[model samples]
Target: MKPELLPLLTCPSCRDGDLTLEAQEEDALGVKTGRLACPTCRTVFPIADYVPSFLPEESGGERWREAWSYKWENVAEQVRYSPEGDEDFERKLNFGNHFSGDFRGKWVLDAGCGSGQDAARMASRGATVVGVDQSRGVYLAQRYNQDTPHADRLHFVRADLFHLPFRPEIFDAIYSNGVLHHTPDTRRAFDAIAPLLKRGGLIGVWVYDRTQYWRLFETFWRPVLSRLPRPALSAFLHAVNRPWHWIYRYRTLMMDKVNPWPESSVARHLADLFSGGQLLYLLTDYHLHLAHRVEDPFIRHHHAFDAYSPTFAWGHDESELFEWFKAQKISVTAISPVRTGLIGVKD
Candidate 1:
């Protein structure tokens, strides 16, 4: 961690004054290794690989941390070699669509930054970004941005959303995409982060929408899949994708109503032969799995694991989110065209 970041940080345990740095190793660049000791509690937090670990002893569950850590560790390679066209452009566009404010010279907080891709994007645009996450993904994020020209403007901290280590109202803007819903209580998580934004500063978040399709998956499949052993669950998901792709490729036959069900004795056989039983997995794996429509298998697996691995994945409609922001005294600024992305200005 850089010495400049010391002023913004506080003790998460006591919310006290700035932590006193006890540098174990230092370089011309800054503190390469150290321990931050809180003045009040005297609790020491380790700073390794230039990322501060602010998580408590038993913060993120083992499986939760492992799943995300593994995903971020490998995602860079998957994004680099995959046939998917320009993941960076997609990320930039997604950020632009949700976050309306000018980022130039802004101090932004990327709450729950997964791999620091978005944080790097913001830093590249002249914004100083503090990217925080609860998992070892903070290491991936720090490594991803360490060599960039914007390295000076980018910072990574391992911390929980519910218990951020920064002083209140320190950020000019905050953007958290596809993050809060994965927390145990999405509403409480929003409340926790809202106070960190300065008055009139923008706060944007994109979460899973409670559509009819997601409702079914959440009620039935997610509960079971989230509990399964990671390896077995991943393998099962990968195995299911094969037939899902086959069905997606031959969806025309199903739409054409070839050998309509119940009327014909050979309906099942026809469906399997022509559409590859598309109806059986249409909502769960075809339509809901947006990657099925794309050509990249790595992207497919990335999206699949992202959707299924998390222990707490909730879905909310526009009204619930809008109400939450309104209760926080934040004025609604914009809701994305998809209605899943919300941006608000703090009052």
Candidate 2:
């Protein structure tokens, strides 16, 4: 780790100045080249290759090992389907006034870094980022980030949210976009990562916006869809949604008549080309959709045990969220109502 960066660090556990960095050797997994010890807490954390391991235990253990396996299984496809086009960028811009200034040398933690897409974005902006994900998402992240200009600064690990293996108070900023909600206990997940932040560190989170549109789908429709086998449901979606794709691909008058876009001819033509109704449906099954270990018989279940476990899928109202944050006593610096983006700073 850079010597200049050391002064900005503090003990993640004690949140005091009693911690000191010890020169330690890198382990087999290239973790914790040094140690950060908190005399107050008697807690020692390892820093691997300059990236601290805040996890309480190993990344791939009992509770979250399956998540890593799932990430490894589907990361390539997930990255491809993630928002990558002009529309996606627009969506991210809509999220809050995050990163209005340069982040050229900031140390950032991308919590729940699914497939490392957001991590890649932060790195592109010149941030030295460490992306942590429970799933084997780190594998794909490492693969995608290896050749970049900031590769030396970018790192990843398969880790749990509850027991992060990182030194406390080391990160300048931490962000988790659309991730905390997916955990078994969202509040616990939030509590786990929040303690690791430095006093002045920024914490930005983009959770699933509680909307009627999402509710209609996630609550009523998704449960119904989750009942079927994966292959059968996927095939059914592909078949039924074929017409939408056909109309989209062909731009025929009849097809447009059935699935209307807008009154204007040009608008109709454009919608047919770009509208993502069918593709969205297919993605619902494979990506956003979840099964209670029905798809994979092996490994432990994370979300659903009875095939209908509620888990942490609960959505919060804006007022409820604000009150929760108030209870935490964190200062809200910026709020973006458009994307339901909430950005805060720890005092």
Candidate 3:
């Protein structure tokens, strides 16, 4: 953790006291190991692997954190964004219209930063980014970005979104993608982060689109999968691996019967082969099991783990999200092409 960020932190325990750092180790990167002491509350937060961790204790059988932590743990490769993915990110956040893209002198916050890939990408754009996640995934993200070109610009913390350890209205911008829906109350989660953004700061989020055909199926199957013993879950993932891919590859066609892209002769032929298996289509998305798809050491498991593993996976429409921004006094700026995500600027 950087000493520069010490003042931005407050005690999650008391929600008001400023934290003092006691660095036990330091390196060229920053404080490598330390403890953050909150004088008023007498609470302590630890810094390790270049991150100050404040993860709330897991209780009430909340296993989503474990699922994401497992994802980073098992993904042997540092997550990469293909060129297309970079473009997709731009579109998801409506960059040209909302953000200058050159983030010099900006303080950005990445809520639910997994593996810190986007944080690194943002830092490379010259923004100083704070990546926070409730899971141990923040540690993985912090360690992964330590050797990155703009490593100094990336800081990480492990804390529940509901109890982020920061003062109000400090960040210049904030984004949470494919994350808010995972919380127990997606809107409340949004409420938690809204206060952190400075007025006029841009904020963006992508939630699961309620239009997806699989929401109901996922709601039913998630409990079974999430509660499974680790070994059984692995077996379950293996069992569905092939069909899962089958669905992913065909999800586009499965989503719309009238879209012409799926009307090609070859696509029709493939569709015919699986005409009787609509059930398989809704069961896909395995998040990360990597390096084992037909024996590729790095083949990632399905995003299905992402879908069904979390205890809360809410879906919402654009208007609903717009109301969230309205209540927060933010102006809706842009919605992604897919309508599942949108960006807003604080008024």
Candidate 4:
């Protein structure tokens, strides 16, 4: 870690300014590696392979841990952009472009970066990227960038959202997509990083939406579904989720048959796929061991945490978020093609 960056960091746990670097251990390769501890909190966050781990302890359980187990690269690579396919990376990237405002020549921070995919895209677009996550997923991010031609412009680190190690004004811009909502305190997590931005520097974050319907789903299902044990609950969900898939197909097939339009193909397909995917994702990944180890090593037990972790499942609507961001003096640039995705810029 840079010595200058250390002075600017406060303990994310106790909000204390006092911290000390206690030890450095090197392997046979003689690489110096260790963690810095907060003198007040006595929390030991890991610093491995030069990346500092700033995330809070796992008291909130495995939601963040499980979600982050998917290597950043794997998550990024999963996005296959197809101009012709019903669903493609290009379409999502097109929607994602709203968040990439004026990123050229900037030092960008990919907060809550599950697998350095977004960071790689930024680097490809000419931004110096820093990918940070609390999980062991950074290893994949490091390896992903290493193989890239622009590896010099990309760096991966293990850092907490509330306890980032960078100095204030270190980044030219920061954006976190599909993160923050997973943390225990979403507002505090946002507050922790707000000060780190340069004056007038860009900031955008895409969190889960909390619309009226979404609220009902959370109130009724997320809480109840998250209560059951992984094995038993997963089995039960797999059996029950079949109906949702049937409904999705039935709706799409009925819609296409009644009013078939070329333009409607994408929307209908997306609706159908999302419906099926959500249930499967919830059942296999969160409730059972179906998605285990298919993508990354650390992710074998990913969804098991989500089954019972409420902290990782919170969300909010765009109107409420717009008001909050406006109060902070941040401007809303776009809400993305998906209502769940939001983009903002700092004044």
**Candidate 2 lDDT by residue in tens digits, 123-229:** 87788877887665566666666666766667775456765656677788888766777676666777778767788888876665677243543565556555555
Give the clashing residue pairs of candidate 1, or none: none
Question: Each candidate's root-mean-square deviation in Å?
Answer: 5.0, 8.3, 4.8, 7.2
Tens digit per residue, CA lDDT, model 3, 1-347 = 88878878898878876788999999898888999998998888888877888866654434667766766665423344334335546767746545547789899999988777677778988999999988777877777778878987888988889889988998999998788988888999999999999999999988888876556567668778777764466556657766656555565455456535454466753564366443443444332222113222123333444555566778899989998999999998788775488888999
Candidate ranking (TM-score, best to worst): 1, 3, 4, 2
Deviating ranges (above 4 Å) for candidate 1: 74-77, 80-101, 253-289
Whole-model lDDT, model 3: 0.74
lDDT of 1: 0.74
Q: Better model by lDDT, 2 or 3? A: 3
Score candidate 3 by TM-score against the native.
Answer: 0.84
- Candidate 4 stretches with Cα past 4 Å from truth are 1-32, 35-45, 56-105, 212-219, 228-311
Q: Write the per-residue lDDT of candidate 4 for residues 104-144, one digit (tens) a residue.
A: 66787878765566778778878878888877777666655
Regions more than 4 Å wrong, model 2:
1-68, 78-97, 224-244, 247-312, 337-339
Models 1 onward score TM values of: 0.84, 0.63, 0.84, 0.65
Q: Compare candidates 2 and 4 on lDDT and give the better one.
A: 4
Which of the two, 1 or 4, has more lDDT? 1
